[model samples]
Target chain A: MAPAVLIEKLQKRYGKVEAVKDVSFQVEPGEIFGLLGPNGAGKTTTIRCICTLATPDAGKIEVSSINAIANPKAARQKLGYVAQEVALDKVLTGRELLQLQAALYHIPGKFAKERIDKMISSLGLQEYADQKTGTYSGGIRKRLDLAAGLLHKPDVLVLDEPTVGLDIESRVVMWDILRQLRDAGTTVLLTSHYLEEVDALASSVAIIDKGVVIAAGTPSELKDRVGGDRITLRIREFCPLEEAEKAKDMLKSFPFVQEAIINVAQGNSLNLVVTPQSDALITIQQALQAAGLPTFGIAQSRPSLDDVYLAATGRTLMDAELAAAGSRDPKAERKQNMK
Target chain B: MSSTVTPSKPNVSLKPEAMQVSPAPGFFGELVQETLALTRRLFIQLQRRPSTLIAGVIQPLIWLVLFGALFQNAPKGLFGDTVNYGQFLAAGVIVFTAFSGALNAGLPVMFDREFGFLNRLLVAPLASRYSIVFASAIFIITLSAIQTSAIIAASAFLGAGWPDPLGLGLISLILLLLVLGVTALSLGLAFALPGHIELIAVIFVTNLPLLFASTALAPLSFMPRWLQMIATLNPLSYAIEPIRYLYLNSDWALNSVVMQAPWGAVTLGGALLVLLVLDVVAFFIIQPLLRRTFA
Candidate 1:
């Protein structure tokens, strides 16, 4: 079967700014595909092009095998998009907003009514359905928006930063709804900057940075390719930089430890990359003790998505986010996002 | 309670087969449905928070009562053959109210673009994105009708005799044409302006000046040569003078002379033709702007 969504060498530029340089990803039917990146990594721009909200400067987008650029209305029918900003008419009640959304997708009246009720209930928006959305809390607004997005049941649901401002409980709930949608055979493609959000929800992820897909694979596959077990050992809650460096130098002497560095940002904790071995943590602890250092906290685990990002790009995702944040102009970005 | 609860099985009701649920009703039917739905949202907003509508109606009513009172002591037949100043000001107030309200038609669209709500409408599979423009026009026209009715009733209550039933229908038609043209231009501005602040600034400066330039306040004869020329050229003058003629003359016809400009005479039918032309030009000018932002 053709992929539910196929974007090939997608290139979108806003004037001189290349928002999406060369993004290519395919989301298979019945799977959750994630586009993980920093804030300005072109994830939203790529989603916008796929959703027919903006035209790409170059490349192809197909929704359920239909050429999206050539047949936008047909492609729009096949894809449901929940934008990062929950754009609800605050004056309209939650139910009213959903009903309006249902009509927009051209759902049959009887079917729309039934499906709208199901969506409202499924998203736990029943009690708040009749109240104006302006009175709703942030989580309630997001839930109502989600219900509206899914009211017409499209083949693929594209979400841009779906959980950006939701509380922890609401975020977890959103993840479950996405999982359910996949189980029911709806291809889900989401763009998120939160590492854990992508890790927890996406079956496969493409990590993008500065408008390019730098890494792509299952979370474990990408982490395993990085090829090292991570050990985070803090000699003390606020270990001195000299003591952390001394411990790092001592840990580097072990045969199994491949690399060690003192992370100055985290109270000067020592991070060690080691060849996979059950006894590696003990050896590091012994080495630290021999150096007259105390192990305030320590953990040994396989590399995470952050490590995969670090392996692909020398900077961590958080650092890339900070860098992107500093360079972004709010006025220019708002203008870009308006259309 | 949590959306993330892993269900025992998938929602069988939402199976992939269900995803192929249906296409819209026929194309035109779908277009009308979406456009009407969007239009309904605007009406709902007006109903719930009626300050704009209330103010729109009251502002014109005040102009009719107060402005008429201000000119009460002027010499007889100084303005026209009308028995009082209220009759002449009635048409001006009606045309001016519709024009001002229509001029603001773009404010909501500009707000939608800024707030990202327009992105919601753009992403939907509407038959044509022009439905967005259509919804705004429909809403603004309906509002013009309401405001026109109130102004007509107030004029008659204030002793400005009612026009014939046929005259009222003509007034309605005239307001529709004027609203259609002005709404198009305003919606275009909504797309062309960078933000709401700039859009509002434009509306603020253009609103009262356009009213004053047209025949809404005084007859063209009361103005200097240049002012009469400007009033004759104003589209609002076409709408105002025709309705004014209908009020002053019960024996009205399409060929009845409505406005006598310094250059020549404009018949009722000719004034309407001008409004129609204005409508066509407004649509033509905004086509590229709407396509740029909406397409």
Candidate 2:
């Protein structure tokens, strides 16, 4: 069978902003595929193109071998999209909202009733199903949005930042539900900026930056490709720049330490990439003591998805997020999403 | 865990044909279902709030009682022969109320667009996106019908005599045509304008000017040449003249002259034709705007 969704050479521009430039990815059936990126990195734009909400300047989008660009109506039938923002009419009850969704998808009346009941129950929204959605908490609202997206049982379920604003408990619950969705033969695709969220839930991921796919692989595979044990050391809670530089210089002399740098954004903490399985944390602590510098905090672990992002993009995701946030135009972005 | 076990149909496949084993409804059936579903939501909103409806009904009555009294002491033969100002103003109130209500049709749609709720409707597998337009038109026209009835009842109670059954029918037909065209333009504005603030601005600038330019508060003869020319050119005038003619004469015919315009006398049949042409022109003007988004 063809990939559940295939987007090749996707390119979209809003006036001068090239939101998605040469993005390509294929999501296999029944897998939780994550598109990892920072804000303004074109993840939502890519999702919009896939869900047929926005037309691309250039690309081939296919759902189950059906060309989404050429035959959008047919492709839309196979795709279910849960946008980043949970949009529900405040006046409409949760059940009424789902009923509207079901009718829009053209599900038969009797079948729609059965499916709506099942969705409400599965999402644990039974108690609140008949209440106005305006009374729902943020978590409950997101759950209702998820239920609406899944009401039709589309072949591929696409979500954009599914857990952006949820608390820790709600985020974990959403993760579990998404996993269950994948196991039940639904092809799940989600975009997220959270490293652990993608690491814990997504089976495979594509890391995008500034509209380009910088890296794509399983989380572990990308981490393995980054290939090192990471050691983060801080001599003080707010380490001085000189102290961090001293630690970085002392750590880089060790044969096992492959690279070292001071992260200026995080209190001038020293980050060291050491050879795998090396007892780098203890050795670094000892060396710091011998050098008369305090070891306020230190950690050693295998490379994570963040390491993959940093290795490919030369900056942490948080730093990229801050940079993107500073330059974003909220008014322009709202205009882009309006249609 | 038991709930998680749901939705696991083993027949999941990537091929399109496999998913189509159960036949879906035809296009028109699906369109009707979706349109009704949307229309139902609007009615539910109206039911719960009822504020807009209450205000819509009350405002027209205020216009009838207060504005009618404003000119109550006018000399006879001011508006027309055998017609009092109260009787003459009922048609204007009916037409103006419906026209303003239809003009505000874009507000809800504009809110929907701004709040991203429209994106939900757009992403669905709709048989045709024009159903969105159809649903809005249906709701606005329905509200117009209710408000029109309220105005008619209030006018008859206030000594503005009721039209005959056929005249009532023609009044409704005129209101329906006017609402359809105005609703189309309002919905088109909802899609074309960037935000609700801009849509409201357009509506504010439009509402009163059109009312004044038409024969809503005065006859064509009461205006100067420039104003009379504009009144004759206004579509609201076309709708108002025929309904006003119906209220004045119990035995009204289509070909009877309803108003003497600056240029010439316009018959009731000619007025209906003008409204129809206005409807056609309004739809044509908004076709490109709707196509950009809906297509």
Q: What is the DockQ of each candidate?
A: 0.54, 0.43
TM-score, model 1 to reference = 0.97
Error of 2 at A107 (Å): 0.9
Colliding residue pairs in candidate 2: none
Q: Per-residue lDDT of B1-295 in model 1, one digit per residue for the tens?
A: 3345432221324664543456636889888989989999999999999888889999999999999999899988888767778888999999988988999999999989999999988888888888889999999999889988988998999988898888888999999999999999999999998999999899899889889999988888789999999999999999999998888788999999988999999999999999999999999999999999767
Off by over 4 Å in 1: B1-13, B17-24
Per-residue accuracy of model 2 over B176-278 as CA lDDT, tens digit each: 9899889989998999999999999999999889998999899887899999999999899999989998988888888899988979999999998888888
- Work out the TM-score per prediction: 0.97, 0.96
Query: Measured by TM-score, how close is model 2 to the native structure?
Result: 0.96
Which candidate leads in DockQ? 1
lDDT of 1 by residue, A1-339 (tens): 999988899899988999989888888888999999999999989998999988999999999999999999899988889999988889999999988898888887878888888887777776789999998876678778777777778889899999999888777767877888888778899999998989898998999988889888899899999998999998899998888777877778788888887888899988888999999878777877877788899999899899989989998899999999899988998898887
Off by over 4 Å in 2: B1-22
